[model samples]
Target: MNQTIALIGNPNCGKTTLFNSLTGTYQKVGNWTGVTTEKKIGQYRKDKKIEIIDLPGIYSLSATSLDQKSALEFLTKTPPSVIINLLDGTNLERNLSLTIELCALNIPMIIAVNFSDKLEERGVKIDLNGISKIFGVQAVCISAIKTKNLDELIDLAKTTTQKPFKISLTAEKGENSAVKRFSFIERNLDKIIIKKGTTAQNKTQIADNLLMHKTLGLPIFFVIMTLVYFISIKLGGVFGGVIKNLFDDAGERLSIYLSEKEVYPFIQSLVCDAIIGALGGILSFLPQILILFAFMACIEESGYASRIAFLFDRFFRAFGLGGKSLLPMIVSSGCTATGIMSTRIIEGEKERKMTIFLSPFIPCGAKTAVFSFFATSIFGGNALIASSMYFLGVLCVGIFGRILKNLKVFKNNKDEFLLEIPDLHLPNLNDVYMVIKEKIKEFITRAGLIVFCVSVFLWLLKSVGLSGYVADRVEDSFLYVLGEVLKYAFYPLGFCNWQTAIAVISGSFAKEAVVESLCLLTNDVGALFSSSYSAYAFMAFILLSPPCVASLATAKTELVSNKWFFGMLAFQTLTAYTVAFIINMIGNIFVWCGGLLLSLIIVIIIAISLIVAVKILSKSKCCACTNACGERKCKNKEKHSTI
Candidate 1:
């Protein structure tokens, strides 16, 4: 008979490392009860008869967060035959609180007291047998990371018999045996364990003192982020270059073959310029986008992000935002859809709302290609000017969040937070590869399907001109009319032609389409539109525009509200137009009328920003604070009292 063994533990308990060891790459998936969080299952390497379920990393069974609720549901509802409860040996007091609850189920369970090495070096000891006796279950000592005594743990798990069900001793029962279990273990500790050098602990303690210092932590976080962005951008460029070359070669071949075949003008335009132009243009940059995601995944897997969250939590709260929002914002700097999906982890209502409202300010992955191509090709890579746009993204979100909080959109919410700071560790390459593969797959799936259809539709729009193909002349196409209408709006940017506006419109599908469309329009696809000021202005516009239609659709799906979806688009467009106008004006400093208009626009946008900030911080009455930080998933309602 096969045994279904569930590995359960608190977050940062090395639970993932343990699962990686037991499963050895055989993990299968399902999502737990109510949410989209994944459920992992795998056949044991040593015993195919034994199956393992790696539950979410949760601290308790109180059903606090959606993640916690899923774990509790799996434990109470599924009733695995054997539970491998991996408890952090150093934090036994807090960790054992949950073990006491699990013990109530009375199913066979083997406690794997991990991190025993760290405990022994701390001059602390644990009596494993004594804990087993009090809990009426088997307990094994194993270091999952080092594979110490792991075979014995696997053997013991195989033999442990199911104990009859029993309730944990409660305070009402007068014994409170959870504490008794700790006392029993402590009394026998000296005989069972030993201590050695305390160097690692001392070093970590000293580092923590400085790292967690209130005055210095925030500044240190900023310094680290500056370094991460620097490395990510530099590395991404190398990878993007290789991918773009392959795409460029393929595109050249296709265009040359079509020209040789003597295809008609409108048909050629529809096939090459519209359809292939849009999708192929952005698909070429998948390498850079994947590289950026891989870099973030490595950091997250190594646990640097948790410390980052701790360092920034209080700062975000001052703007009525959450520290958890940092991860989404950072991810959004690569892609907004990924950023929006990441919001699911934020527990507080105010925090989640604020993150959703502000995530668009980050320059997504697609837009960065525009920055790279334009910055180097046109301006010879002016680092200071290029970097200013990144800071502008941050400035927008911070100021926007503060301003919105005082409005009807966020009247009754004052954000507050608590976070668990996991220790830094080496990132697993397997995990890194897995993340990169998933992101690349998502990008391809979208580019091939949605983007392909949009490209074909755009081709149809550009094909119906009045003269050569469909009507009297080449200038009367369906797309020409729309482009002509938009020409005046972009007059200040110095590229006031219909082709530039049409490129911006098609760019809603994929950002690189702007450059590609311009290339197609002028029949010189490489380094053709080399106006540096105009290039800078156009890149800025694409960066700040509403995220592609795919991302907006994803936002609607995730938020489950059209209200949030439309609101994001409206805010994004407003910010994009305003930012673009400012950049265009500044770029045209030598042009008299453009420079004057740009100065006036800057003054107006800044004054509006100040008024918005004043309005968001205005106070409001609320009775929601008591349990606001205490719940998650947001499906349950809490009883409230008047403040």
Candidate 2:
């Protein structure tokens, strides 16, 4: 029978890189019972008897946060046969503390010294035998990022059986023991390992110094993000072109065939309009999303992400949110569902909840469709507005945090924000390919499984008459009833109609459904609804609204409370309505904002809040929040427990 082995390591220690190399895509991603952090299981191809569990990156087994607790539960409750401990060669002293902590579990273990190339470049060395002796475990010199001796390392892991290694737990006593460990690891490093650091090492160091600069770093970081946005836009445009052509061709051919068959126009229009035209039109963009993820996979694989977190932590901490928020926020840029799921990495309850509530602010891949459609039509593809929407999302998150800081529900909470900064290395092609493949698989599965059923159901709602299976326009469809009732309240926002309202209501299931439904509504409401600027404004309203169904479900799972989930939903809805109302009113002014203007009051209220935050609490509150980035000040952050 096959036994299990696990590779446990601190964040940024090249753990995922190593796991990907070891198991490739022979991995399973699922959920742990009662928690939101995803579980991963894979088997090493080299040894059928050896299975690999790639747990979340955690600093220590005992830490109370989600990932750390997961590690401890796995190790203590059901210890693996062997633990492959990955130690950062450059940050050995800190990484070794985790090693020391793991040793106490008496679990059979081996240490893999990673980033050796970085160590040698920094004039640092490590004695492998010395480390092995000190930790009482087999230590192998390997570089997961560089793929040096990787196969041999796996071969060594295969030889090890399920047996615990016994070691006494004692922090070597001294006022400067941690410092001493750092010094000792540095001075004696050469005895165990030799490194011929190349130019990559120098580049990482240089990048790190500049990226962490107090001021210029942020501007540079934004520029880099702008590049990512630019790429996403270009890739989306290209992919969208292909999808549009295919959709038109398919729609036309299908229409002609139905007519030749003398099929009823009602049946023909229902099949063509509701099924193929709407759903197919939206799904055509999946290629673009998958391609974007492919590029991101490479960047994340190389470990440059740690430096980004570290750099942003300086400013992020001052806002009462963990710097770890950056990753989830980036994920939100792709899709709010993915972003909400990524919140598993955040340890603090307040922080995690905050991230979840705020994540939807960043426009997701689904919203990209709406943005490209309107921004170009309205402002000649004004990149600034598109970019401004993203920043506006972040700003909204920060401002929301500021308002909630003094609330009774979130009082006196100290956030321990600390993380690992791994040495930078170029992402290997193999690893990048693995992540992209898995992400594509995930996207396909979601579309094929969850969204597929929903889309079909949505098509039915759009085809069948609302009053009970009668034939008529989409207004006669079932969604129209629900949308009409809600539409009455939205009249002031200028989109008080079922077709427009239905798309926004349906978006909560998954935001892409918004655009998908809109595609369905187009022919019916084209001239009356879509021709005006309110069309773009209404799109913006739904785009910034509450997260999708999957995200809300995830938030419920993560925060363990529906109260907060709905609370977030309510706020998101209110904000969407208010925002849409103001924007519509503003545009109408450029066109015709006479005196039917409750819109002006809404803008004034928002402006007043922004002024209050900037004038009163912006600077001080930001500085008080603990930073969980990779830095000296954030080094000792263990985990802040969430209620």
Candidate 3:
């Protein structure tokens, strides 16, 4: 008979890490909460029949957040044969609270203490035998990262037997269950756990004091992100140029060989221009993507990500988001779909929906290709321009968040932020390798499947006309007619050419398709833009536009309502167009009015127009109540005060 085991624990207790070690799966693991927001299943490597289910990290059985609800539902509906109660060795006191809750379920369990390797460095010790004797379950100390004593843990799990253990609380009579549980833990903890000193904790505290300073914290974060982009874009570009040249040479050689071999002219264009050219342009940015993922992995594994969430909590609350929202936003930099899924960790429904609506503003890895291309070709290879797009996305999120918070639909009565900070340590090299490896695999897979298919379809559209097979006359092709019809919509934002219009439209399918379409349409991408100003406007449009089809589908599922999903789509489209139009108008002012004074006057006038527009849009329909205002208490004492 096959036995099923479930791994359950407090957030960041190394349950996912141990699952990966036992099951040999490459599931993403980080030193922060919400990394595993959904349950994952994999077979035990040693015995395939023994299934391992890695459930989302939960503090207690009380289902408050979406992730907790999922875990709770799964445990109650389908009780596993055995439960691996993973505990963080350094923070056993807090972790034991959940263990106490799980004990009430009466399921056979094995207590696996994680981070045992760090106990000595942190001046702490745990007696495994003593814990086993006290808890009435088999207990073992194991280091998931180091893969130490994992075999012993598995052995204990296989032969796990539950013993009747009752918690006798000595607290006050009216104490809550939580207080009673902690009281029991405090009374019994001294027997099995020993604390020698706080040497390691002191060092971490000293570092946090400087890094998390009130004034310096935000600036430090910006500096770190800027440096990450600098290394990823500027340094990686050197390698990208080499790859581009190789592809260019190969395309040239293949085209020549096809022509010499008397191949069909249409076939030659399809193979050389559409397939090779488009793939080359995108594949050139692989180094930069790899480097960016590496830096993100390092930040997550080094335990600085959770500190960022904590540091930004107060700041985020002002914009109607809790600090917990930052993790999803951070993950959005890689993939908006995954980021939307991560919002399950947020406790409030209003905040989670708002986060889902705003997360697509952040440029995902697909948009990274588009930005990198423009930065290299038009912006004089300045990585700052590409990196600034990220901050621009954040600015949009903040501006929209403030506006939406005042609206009745998105208003939150109270936003609570809760996060557990993990200890700082050097990133495990193996974990970093796995992250980079998985990211590369995804990138290549998309390039192979989506990009390849889109490139071929686009080539056919550009090749055939009303008369069919236009050959060299691309102006007479079917794609040109379609682009011509849509070009007028983008006239105010600059880049009114058909090619640029087509590229933007294709981006709705896949953001990377923007770059692929552009490469497939024209040999000189710079020629599509009239000036650098127009290029910047186009880039801004891409930055703020609704994400790709997959992301839209994800938003629909996450939002769980057609009305809100369509509202989000409309909001994103309008925001993108309005921002891009403003940028283009401002750039034209600088060009048309050469004098600095005149340009400044025009810019001020435009800014004033924008301010007025925002004020008008933000005007709320007041309710006849003393506290009608969503974000603030109404100043009017009379219920019939003037609107």
In lDDT terms, which candidate is top? 3
TM-score of each: 0.76, 0.82, 0.91
Model 1 ranges off by over 4 Å = 1-3, 20-51, 115-127, 142-161, 164-200, 209-220, 253-280, 377-380, 450-453, 456-476, 482-505, 510-518, 521-538, 581-643
TM-score of 2: 0.82
**Over the stretch 1-643, how does candidate 3's per-residue lDDT look in tens digits?**
9889999999889988999999998998888776887789999999899899999888887746667788888888999989999998988888988888887778888998998888876668788787877778888888999999998888777777674266555669799888888887888798779654465446668778767878898899989988987787777778888998998999999999999999999999989988888778778878877887888889888888888888887667667787878878887887887788778768778898889888888888778878988997788888788878988899889888888888899874366566777777788888999988897888788778777777788889999999889987989999999999999999999989899999998888878899889878887999899888889999999988998877888888888989999999988999999989988887887788767956678788789868866864565545555455542335553654553
243-318 per-residue lDDT for model 1 (tens digits): 6666667666777888899877566656656666665566667766777777777656666666666777766765
RMSD of each: 6.9, 6.4, 4.7
Candidate 2 at residue 438, lDDT?
A: 73
Sort order, TM-score high to low: 3, 2, 1
User: Candidate 3 — what's its lDDT?
Assistant: 0.83
What does candidate 2's lDDT look like per residue over 199-231, in tens digits? 354676787778767778888878877777788
**Deviation from native of the Cα of residue 245 in model 3, angstroms:** 1.1
Give the Cα-based TM-score of candidate 3 against the true structure: 0.91
lDDT, residue 76, candidate 3: 86
Alpha-carbon deviation at 400 in model 2, angstroms: 2.4
